[model samples]
Target chain A: MAAAAHEPEVIRDKAVMRAWSRCRRAEGKAVALVPTMGFLHDGHLSLVSAAVAAAAGPVAVVVSIYVNPSQFAPTEDLATYPSDFAGDLRKLAATGAVAAVFCPPDLYVRGRAGHPAAGASGGAVSCLEDAGGHAHETWIRVEQLEKGLCGSSRPVFFRGVATVVSKLFNIVEPDIAVFGKKDYQQWRVICRMVRDLDFAIEIVGTEIVREADGLAMSSRNVHLSCEEREKALSISRSLMNARTAVLNGNNHGQQLKDEIVQTLKEAGGQVDYVEFQSLTFSLD
Target chain B: MAAAAHEPEVIRDKAVMRAWSRCRRAEGKAVALVPTMGFLHDGHLSLVSAAVAAAAGPVAVVVSIYVNPSQFAPTEDLATYPSDFAGDLRKLAATGAVAAVFCPPDLYVRGRAGHPAAGASGGAVSCLEDAGGHAHETWIRVEQLEKGLCGSSRPVFFRGVATVVSKLFNIVEPDIAVFGKKDYQQWRVICRMVRDLDFAIEIVGTEIVREADGLAMSSRNVHLSCEEREKALSISRSLMNARTAVLNGNNHGQQLKDEIVQTLKEAGGQVDYVEFQSLTFSLD
Candidate 1:
């Protein structure tokens, strides 16, 4: 409601975003940046809404819709990543409090207008071969948080995520940023990185949005077959079962994870990993 | 010579430094930061001088003297690392142009006054164990540059270096920062990090200053035995020989490396590694 009357500005350049954020900062206004890999869903809208709620008044909500390449492994879904810019902007606008949508083509690559980093801007994107031949090599990592959970399977995942998020924080200089709890580990990683680096940015975690049947909303959810989608319900059901078990005083982590693994297995689902980090979102 | 008339201020508080920098920014004054691990040798003084030279008109030169903990491994010399705070300050004062000397006891460790970052300032150093039990876990890494050279041997070395350097940059916000080329690989890593991260600070590399005998100046040079010191000269001599071989168009890489290894071996030095990467300081 604080930003209800504000019209959202669509920005493509990092300099423009910075200048915009700077103007907001000079006006003593708080800026909240919601960084997403696009393909927006109800879950992303929830995060954008949370970003809006994080500040009292004079808030600038900028949602970045760049598909960060660094977070994906060479063999992962980067090439197959989904995008619907028109829909994403429409959803962002529906949030009412959103003030800007940053849809840079590239945010972390050596080529394109994405962030104009990697190589100096104004140079042709094709000059990557002449401008040192590989993607930008700097990385930011939260060693402890990235060590467990999804990090064990995808070693480069958190590194890429942390680096790009760091770049965004630098570019926007946001007063607050929001991440969905569905990405519990990633949310924690971002929070720890911000605290450790003394960025003076507050990281807020928005609750996960779920389907009516309790399937956690994800862009990757589009990849599941109809039968696989049915099987996926077991994953959520297992978490709910674990929560119920914990409520009944079954605090043993290994036992809870074993139960979840067995439940998923019985439901015709394959578990890539079943880790229990902290009783925190190690559960999520 | 411009700094000759200005007395340096010793600031331990990050807030004070930021306020001072903000004041400088308002006055259109340029600032140069010289980051050092501070056993303050003539080499570090040269870096300070270079930082001073990098800026024109009104300039503020800041030299950070904290011995960063993240850069040292557990088995490395962190515990026994030498510190001569009084002597270091004397040398920093001798630089004449330095506007501030930031010598926090702990920068990467959450426990010490090292920037008083993790918790609010004016708190006792004892707050670390109670505040947070572990060392800071966030790291900044240069993917390509850190893969070779000293990095191959000390895997965690550059991550620690990069993270601490990044923290320093954020804390000081200097207009220009200087790295000495005695550490050519590290210099490159810092340059790449600054460029890739979109840090507006200008990164300048000062020429390596060496002793009359040609051994590069280093804080660790104090730890070498007389016999080992002479043996180390073979390492430099071998490099000079390899340079001559390259200039003579004997471009066989292995032959040149073997020549250096053999020369060091003959001089009672053990070669830990021999590598060639982009003609950079892959040997460092």
Candidate 2:
């Protein structure tokens, strides 16, 4: 725990990161992973602490800070996504929980070794064709879980998330991984993925960290004006109200979803969707 | 070489297989993998031998024998696929190359721990939902490479191949994997997948193993009648003719394909497809 306060090593190469994890594993030490985009916030740090606490024995924590391009669509904020490499490092260092920062500039390096463009720096091309007419064509998908939520609007979102996470799991080779439940579907999709793929690592889902004023902490919160931020509060409020309603014996899923959608619309929020899938849905 | 002649230990559990490979790795030994769908022929043995020859140092060769159900469709011959586990083991033992055989009855268990069906033995459900309403939803796809050849006819084939192979790689943690070029498109798809996914393992594609009559060795060959077997000879002959034509100044891709198709048709062989993809296509 004392070594956790030191400056974390920033690993830019995939091989180096993998070797670091492998070395830790070889030493009979557990490696905990917290995957994130660069602009680290309290929610991200909470996931890091969650990873640290979740480890049973002495553990080496790795925080991957790549802003994965595969998880973003062309129309999305991929180009405009906020980043602060230096600030992120300082934040992680402040957490006193992280051991290393795996800030690989590009995880999706095209055509490494086998293809025609083997050594060329074909960096971070999405699942689509790169400028060189070549592409990183392999993708991982969680078919059933990825559907209905964000998958409906962002057709390529879950595929991107699943693929990049698979890359991280393979490279980091962590004993356990932590994900924030703010992105509920993503966390479930990943849990399903690790299970289906037979990844030996355990998946830890942590609760979403929210601001004192009740808004969930997100990097995109920086983009919102005060008025927009106030309007976004309705999302958490409606969810709390729905929970209260469910506790009060109003157990209809569709009715709660309709109420939440109406609440968001009334609060001047543009509601893309409001879905409720039963967590207790029996597989049997 | 003495270790090679010892009977290969059969491994069925995923955890045990991972432990076997990890222990070998910890001892500074390389583990090579040869994946097959049972009913092993000389072709599969050749691949096991190639894995032995490919290693620079002492290596533990692992062969996985599973008839993956995800790659086959409901309309396809999933149930009818040939399998001979006992015979396959004898053939591999005779080769004196394989160190271990990973023959898991099912890799796609519906849920291990996170799902409602945890520890329920919901075995080997394809991408589709099972009778218990649970499924293994995760899948891997080599998009561009899988598009043209067998992918065209069997839409789910390469995704199945890519996904299952990924499971094997994660479980076996092999230093290198040997794939036979008899499934030419499959080999290419897997190579592309390993490159794109940043898997540390190496993929070695071995040449197609042919019988004395020049027919590619396949498990399905047992189903062929004498006349059907004679007609199948046209496939390898046409490929040889096309190669000869290419060497003799017939560099036109489509022209060679047309000639091959014509030859197969003339020999009363029903041609599903005859096409060419230039392996030398420059990514630049």
Maximum-TM-score candidate: 2
Q: How many angstroms is residue A76 displaced in model 1 relative to the true structure, after the best TM-score fit?
A: 3.7
Fnat values, candidates in order: 0.63, 0.81
> lDDT for model 2, on a 0 to 1 scale?
0.82
Candidates in order, TM-scores: namely: 0.77, 0.89
lDDT of 1 by residue, A125-146 (tens): 2222233446676767676677
**Residue pairs whose backbone atoms clash in candidate 1:** A106-A114, B106-B114
lDDT per residue as tens, model 2, B23-82? 988888899999998888988888888898889999999999998877775567777889
Residue-level error in angstroms, candidate 2, position A240:
1.6
lDDT of 1 by residue, B164-184 (tens): 788887778778999988777
Assign candidate 2 its CAPRI class: acceptable
Using DockQ as the measure, the top candidate is 2
